[model samples]
Target: MRKWREIFGASQTDVAKIMGISPSVVSDYEKGRRTPGVKFIKRFVEALIKVDNERGWVVCKELIKSLNLNPEVIIDIRELDKPMNLDTFVTLVKGCLLTSTHSQKIIYGYTVLDSIATIQSLSGNEFWQIMGLTTERALIFTKVTTGRSPMIAVRVAPVKPAAVVLHGPKKVDPLAIILAEKEKIPLILSLASDVNELVNSLRTYARVKIIV
Candidate 1:
């Protein structure tokens, strides 16, 4: 309950107001001090969705879109409690920035993907699941060869990630760099040893709070 409220960028008061309850009641439910029945749970979820809808359905829409994605394509996905600078995320992943673009540097979340599985399994519309809860997140592609395919997919997608990281690729394709620059999306090459190492690094980073 707390997670959903936070993901929607809503306060306990906000959800309580929408659900016609007191803020303390909402807090109690989230803290497990008070058990909620099925009817309350339904109202609680509807309240969160209503709050999100009032705010343009940003998080709500993304979550719905993500349900259609294949589990094999997405190794991991998480939303940060606070936004982190793009540079900090790059450093944590031992990444090298290939593109000069810096227009969108703040990221709210990350999604780690199996490069081959994603490219082969997802269609055009389903590809947006890579953004997870928001487009302001890093899309890390693992098992990359030339890094061209992922970049190409991003180019055709309706939305773009704050940054793109290629893992397991010693050399990135020149065209991928060009596409990233054209889109103004920071292109990164990660030096993490493997997918497990990469995911662990990101998990550690997510636990740390960044003031910015």
Candidate 2:
């Protein structure tokens, strides 16, 4: 239960909302000071499933199997450029097959391309989920710089007041941008092209200037 709280980036208050209780009640439940009924336990698990479904969690399938849940009650966001992991991918597919809404698209406006790209995994450390994954889509605008570049700014799923940054020559892609926004992972797109041309690409995502 503690692990689910972190993974969903949920607050005690959010848990209370899901469980129809107060924040203090959630704290008590977490500390094992309170014994919950079967109904409360089911609601708690369902809340976790809802959170994971929006952020594209495939492990939610395992959660269902282990818990013997109906897929119709599950929230599934499968329209990503790529699934973050195969287990999650399988879960999404399996859930979709079992659902009436198999053709729903969760992510749009991102295109995939062939290029050398690097992905970094962040520590699921406590400080990592201050912003919480509240939205299904996060919009990222990237403009690469050639010689000397302007600083880059990023916002992702679990936002922190202090920015986490990456600087290198990995050209950004629409797909990566969308994924970063969806997953709330900070990303940088390095380029060797003219700065203005790179900045112009920002028009694709938003009018906001991301001077990178």
Q: Which candidate should be chosen as best, given lDDT against the real structure?
A: 1
Candidate 1 global TM-score = 0.68
Best by TM-score: 1
RMSD of each: 9.8, 17.1
For all predicted structures, in order, the TM-scores are 0.68, 0.28
| Candidate 2 weakest ten by summed lDDT | 111-120
- Residues 1-212 of candidate 1: C-alpha lDDT, one tens digit per residue: 88878988999999899888899999999999999897798678667766776777687557655577676777777655467887777788899889894845998778888988877888776777555334788888999999999899889888888899999888899999999999999999999888899988888756321111
What total of clashing residue pairs does each candidate reach? 0, 3
Candidate 2 local lDDT, 79-139, one digit each (tens): 2433223223223222111111212223221211111110122223311231232122222
